[model samples]
Target: MALLHRAEIRPTKLELLSAWLPGRPWFQGEAAAGVERVAAYRFDDPAGQVGIETLLVRAGGGPVLQVPLTYRGAPLGDAEAWLVGTCEHTVLGRRWVYDACGDPVYAAALAGAVLAGAGQAEEYFEVDGHREHRPPSMVLTVDGAWRATAPGLGAIDRVEDGDPTRIVTDAVELAVVRHVGTEPGPAGARLSGTWDGQPAPLPLASAAPR
Candidate 1:
C-alpha cells in the first residue's frame, strides 16, 4: 500500500518535467508544451526507503511518454546525468529526483513486479485523520514465464537510451517503453497497463535475461 500525504511540492512535477523532457535524447518531440499528467502508477519499496512512480504525460497533443521517477532523501551518486532535478517536499524536506532507468531501487521494483506478478501499490489519503482508499491512477499486468522470481536484482550494469529504456542488471534485463503503444510486442515476459480513462491496455515494458 502507498500512503500519500497532502503536502505541497515546489515546482510541481509537470513544471520539472517540462524543462527536463526535451533535453532527453530519446524524447522525439520537438518541444514539450502543455504538458499534462494523464495518469501515474506507483511501486512500493520493501524497505520503505524510496518513492517510486511512473508518470504518463502528454505534451502538445503528441505521443504519451512514460517517465519513471524515484524520489530519495539524498542524491544518488553516479546518476548526475539522469537527474531530473530536485524539489522541496512540504512533509519530507528536500528530495532528489532522478530518471528511474538509472536507479537501482526502480530496477529492483520492476524486476519484482514482473517476475513475481506484483501489481501497482494501492494508494490512500489521510483527511482529518481518516484514511481513505483511492483507486490507483493506472493499472498494470504482467505475464509469461513461470519463473516468478529473480535470484536477486543485482546492481544496474548499464542503461541504453531509446524508445524503450533498456536496463541491464546482473540477473535480468528490463525494457521500459518510453513511447507506449496500443499494439503488443513479443517478449519473454511483458508488463501492460491501462490509464485511468483509457480502457485499452498499453504495453509498458518487457523483460528477459542479459
Candidate 2:
C-alpha cells in the first residue's frame, strides 16, 4: 500500500495542527495561542486504513518538539470533544477535524509502527511544565529483526520472547511482561510492568494514550 502524504489527507493535516498544538500538555504556547507549521511528514502503515503523521511546528520561540499522530474514521464518534479544530480545503470542499493524541486508533497505530521498524529513534530534551521530559533512552529489539534505540532517564527495553514480550530496564527498576493478542484493533496486546519491584499492568489502550 502507498504511504499517505500530507497533501493527500483531506483538508491538510497541517491546518489541523495549527489548531491542535496549543492544547497538548507538551505545548508551551499560550492557552489560546495559534501555531504555524514549520515541517511535517507521513509514515506508511501496512494497514492502509490508518494514517500516521509526524508534525513539527513553531509556536513563538519554543523549541520544536515532534508530534506524531494517527488518523481514522471507522466508528467515528465524538472526535471533536478532544479536537483542536478543523482543517479546510478550498479545492476539496471538505474539512477534516480530529484530536491530536487522545484517540486510541492513532496511539495503536504509532506503537505498531514503532514495533514494525518504521520509527526513528530520537530524543526531546525540553518539554512544557505539565509534560514529562521523555528522552529516548531505551533500546528495543523486536524478534531479532528490528532495533529501536532510545535515550533518557526512565528507559524501557522491549523484546519479544516467544509468546510473552519481555521488557527489562535498570534505570527505572522495572520488568515488563506483555501478552500479545491474536487480533488487532483496541485489543491488540496487553502489557504489565513491575516498577520498583511492584507489579503494574498497563492495558494496551492505556499505554498508548495516557
Candidate 3:
C-alpha cells in the first residue's frame, strides 16, 4: 500500500512540470499556456526506498503526454540531465525528482508491470491520524505473458529518449509510450491504461526479454 501524508507541497507538481516539460525533445505542446493533469498512476518499489509515479498531462489541449517520474530524498548519481528539479514537501522536506527513464527502480517496476502482470500500487491517504484508501486516478491492465522465470531487472544498461522512451535492462527491454493516443503498441507483453472519458484502452508500455 502507498501511504500519502497530508502535507503541503511547494512549487506544486504542475508548476514544476510546466517549467521542465517544454525543454524535453519529445515534448510536443507548449507549456506556456500551462499544463493540466489529466490522470496519474503509480507503482510501488518493493524496497520502499523510492516513489514511482506516471503522470498524464495535457498542454494547450494537445494530446496527453506521458511522463514517468521517480521521487527520492537524494540526488541520483550521474543523472543530472534527467533531473526534473527539486521541490519542498512540507512534511517530507526537500525531494529530488528525476525522469523515470534513468531510474533503475522505475525500470524494474515497469518491467514487472509489463512482463509479470503487476499493476499499479494501491494508495492510502492519511489525515489527522486517520487513514483512508484512495482510488487510483487511472486504472491499468497488462498482458501477462507469464514466463518460467521473472525478469532480470538488476541493472539498467541504457536509455534512449524520444517519443517512446526506451529502457534496456539486464534481462528486459521496456518501451514507454510518450503520447496517450498512439495506436498499435510495441511487440511482446504490454500494458494498457484507461481513465474517465477515455473510450478505449491506451497502450502505456511494452516489454520483451533481452
Candidate 4:
C-alpha cells in the first residue's frame, strides 16, 4: 500500500485547507481569508489509492479547527452529489477533487484509521460553534454499528446499528470521543462515548461551546 508521510504530501494539506475551508458550512472565516496549518497527520490504508488526513487549521480568531478529510482519484461517480468541495490538485497534478464522506471507500479508510489510533479528539468541535471541543474516543462494533457523543452528550446515540449485511467501508473514527452501536431510529447506528472520563450528554448541540 502507498502510505504518504505528512512531509510527503504535495501542496501541503494546509495549503489545500486554505482553499477548501471557506466553503464549508462549519467554517467561520472571512471570505478569502487565509488559513494556516497548526499541525497535521495521516492514517495509512492497506490500499494505497485512498488517503485520510487529520488537519488543524488556524483561521484567525477562532480556536484551531480540525478537519478530517479523504482524497481519491476520479469523481467518485454518483457520490459526487454530496461532495464538500473539489478542485484541481496542483499537488498531484490532477484536475478533479473529491469529498470522502460521499465516497464509501474513503469513509471506510477513515474508520480504519480511527481503529489504528491515527487520530485524537482534543481538536474536534462542532462545525457551527468552532469552539466546542469533543473528546478523542471512538466506538467500533463487529455488527456494523456506530455512534458519536460530543462533550456533555450522554451514552451512544445510535448512528447505525444492525446486521453486518455489507462491508461498505472498513472503519470510521471521530477526532473526538464517539459511541458505536447497532440500533435503529434517530439514534440508530450512532456515536456514543465519554468526554474527559465523564458520560457524554445528549443532543450534542445542547452542551456549551468550549
TM-scores, all models, native as reference: 0.93, 0.44, 0.95, 0.47
Q: How do the residues 92-198 of candidate 1 rate in per-residue lDDT, one tens digit apiece? A: 88999999989998998887787677778888888889989988778888877446454476777888877788888787888888887833233667888987677
Candidate 3, residues 25-83, lDDT tens digits: the string is: 88878678879999999999988989899999989967899999999999999999899
Candidate 3's error at 79, in angstroms?
0.9
| lDDT computed for candidate 1 | 0.83
**What tens digits encode model 4's per-residue C-alpha lDDT throughout 1-210?**
232222344455566667766665556655456776554444454465666554456676654454546676656666554444544454454423343444455444444433332232233333444455443343222222332431222222222211211222222222221111222122123322222233432211001111
lDDT of each: 0.83, 0.38, 0.85, 0.40
lDDT by residue for model 2 over 78-130, one digit each (tens)? 55555544444443334444443444444434344433334432332223333
Supply the TM-score for candidate 4: 0.47
Best by TM-score: 3
Which of the numbered candidates is closest to the native, going by highest lDDT? Answer: 3
Which candidate, 2 or 3, would have the higher lDDT against the true structure?
3
Clashing pairs in 2: 136-150, 136-151, 137-150, 137-151, 137-152, 138-150
Evaluate model 3: give its TM-score. 0.95
Better of 1 and 2 by lDDT: 1
Clashing pairs in 3: none
Per the 3 Å backbone cut-off, how many clashing residue pairs does candidate 2 have?
Answer: 6
By TM-score, how accurate is candidate 2?
0.44
